[model samples]
Target chain A: MAKPKIATTSLAGCFGCHMSLLDIDERILELVELVEFDKSPVDDIKNFTGRCAIGLVEGGCCNEHNVDVLREFRRHCDILISVGDCATMGGIPALRNTVPLRECLDEAFVNGPSVHNPDGKYPDDPEIPLILDKVYPAHEVVKIDYFLPGCPPTADTLWEALVALLNDKPVELPYQLVKYD
Target chain B: MSQSVMFMIDGVQVEGRAGQSILEAAGEAGVYIPRLCYKEGLSPHGSCRVCTVMVNGRPMSACTSPISLGMIVENDSPRVAQLRRDLIEMLFVAGNHFCMFCEKSGDCELQALAYRFGITAPKYPYMFPKREVDASHPDIFIDRNRCILCGRCVRASKELDGKNVFQFVGRSAEKRIAVNGEALADTDAAVTDAAADACPVGAILKKGVGYVVPVGKREYDDKPIGSDIEAKRPAAGS
Candidate 1:
């Protein structure tokens, strides 16, 4: 049987979840044997080549580009998994949910101690992704089939979930394997 | 000393002294009933209902409900566990618990209970309510965003420290922990006080001492909370 195709991405996150995926260490060799990588930073594939069996999204929707990428994954993948606290519950980025967007932007771009905006300008570049009013977990924007909650889910958790999904077995998570941070 | 009272918890016989709660007796028997807001050596407020169990076929807070002679308690059941998970989920959404950036992430009892209940994500909608972070104290910081309102700090201050520096202000959704005075610095509260350490969440944290424990080495890293209680501690003179 052909190996299952897996695509992964990090949107408003620190890319720590991807780091934990790689923390699987030598198990990456076994992972390769079980599933094929597609549209993932691991393979440096910029776009999805075909339909993927699973999509691992690591982060919440913080901007227009994040929503675009997340919706695109939902459209192209058979199963979508929110793979970290950010994707699951907006994590640290969602802290801005409490503050107004205009205030946050002003603080960051205009009145910040290090900012030298003599022109009193804010980012209005056409190329920059428009920031959303509030950071939202992936499930809030797009349907998420599963969620592995952690700042970066331990490597063992990622590996176990992947192994179970690939083999058509139930994901049996141990107490120590699950954490928020 | 009071005579021991015998009880059955989930079909296992456990014994405790008169006036002891079911939760305390269960702990002595090496049983863990998932709970928050019920710290030992403090008054039981029965605030967080994570430790809800079936006492004689009726749901009751194990921490606040006293165990009587021959009382039957059901600690672990699908219904009980689901109740716990639901309570935990409520706490998660009610508070802006951004665990990744929290100073008390790994060491937090609330987070640990969530992990124990296998909660991947709360089923409730995120409130994301605007909260305050009071950094006025020279040695402590109170981030209302992470407070679960368990009243552990309130009890610790009034009962243990004898300072009565903390109290609950407001009501319902507006309820929150508050230092008695204008600022925590002006109050009798100190960083070394038991109240600071009594917080189950990251609401009250000691300043200048964040993340000293590495990400994976903090409390509840390799084991679940209350692991010590269930470790079959040796009896006296063993």
Candidate 2:
């Protein structure tokens, strides 16, 4: 059978989850044989968009750039996967969610340790993004078909989710991953 | 850890009016079934298999299992004895465990458990995983080599402590605990009493508390699980 077209993108995250995806070792080579990498931030495949079979979205929506990137993936993919803890439950970065947005911004920029001084003595870069009032799961904004929850979903979990989706089987998750509040 | 009005231990009638664990009964009865990774005032976590005992004739962590009425528990069965020995030997081989230099030598639960099971060396070839120490916190130093990854500290940090600071990274045998995405400062954020109160080993030692508690003087080998029970306790001062 022909390989399914897969695309991947990272938003306002540290990209740890994407790195974990690539950390599949020899199985990564196996994945290379199974699916066609269409447009991935890590794969350096830019502008390739032919109706993605599986579009893996990492990180939560944190800024304008992140929102726009997610919109693009939502527009293209057939099955959108909100991958990792960030996409699933906004992850630890979402701890910022509990606090006010202005306080967070002031803490990072205005009252920061002088290094992050947003004024930059004169003008801040226009392209620089701003943090949102709250960090949210990916599904809050866009439709998500499946979620792989973890701080960074383990490589086995990432592989398993993909294989299940490709073969139309149910994804099995360990109780440890979901049992905790 | 909530107080149970009624629970059983060893098929013999015993009062489990409080949410006491199987080990509590064993300890109260002066039974000396050995255990590592279980400390008083810390939450009961079934990490170190040294605490494994025959609950209904099957091996289970005596520290974590809550006592239910009429539950048959055996701490001295041959199977549990073998399992304890095997588990203690694994812990010894995994870490240097040089007791001579350790501060909590006489009072160490890990050492006591090993002694109870008569495990000096492991039957398997020694395979010590190399680890680094993190003393980022002024009060406490983390010896990664000593951690058995029972997740008592990690769970305490997230559930009891409310910091949700630490987490486990890697997979299976390669698994090790990490702090706030490997950033030490992340632990400073949401630490509740649960993490500190629930740590079963020296992995999460109290900062500036060693001098206060002294060596032979901590909560005895048996103390109730604190906040872990508060969730289930009634409105009373239980």
Candidate 2 CAPRI assessment class? incorrect
Separate DockQ for every predicted complex: 0.76, 0.01
Which parts of model 1 have CA positions greater than 4 angstroms off? Answer: A114-127, B233-238
lDDT of 1 by residue, A82-107 (tens): 99999999988988999999999989
lDDT of 2 by residue, A49-127 (tens): 6888999988888887778778888899989988775675565566566467777767765776765655535225787
TM-score of each: 0.92, 0.46
Top candidate when judged by TM-score against the true structure: 1
TM-score of 2: 0.46
Question: What TM-score results for chain B in every one of the models?
Answer: 0.95, 0.69
| Residue lDDT tens for model 2, B116-144 | 44332245533435566777765555777
lDDT of 1 by residue, B1-238 (tens): 8889999988877888888888887888788888889999998988898889999999999999988998999988899988988999999999899887788988999888887777899888899998888898899889999999999999999999999999999999999888889978779888889998998889999989899999779998888787888787445355
Clashing pairs in 2: B3-B19, B4-B18, B4-B19, B8-B68, B8-B69, B160-B194, B161-B192, B163-B190
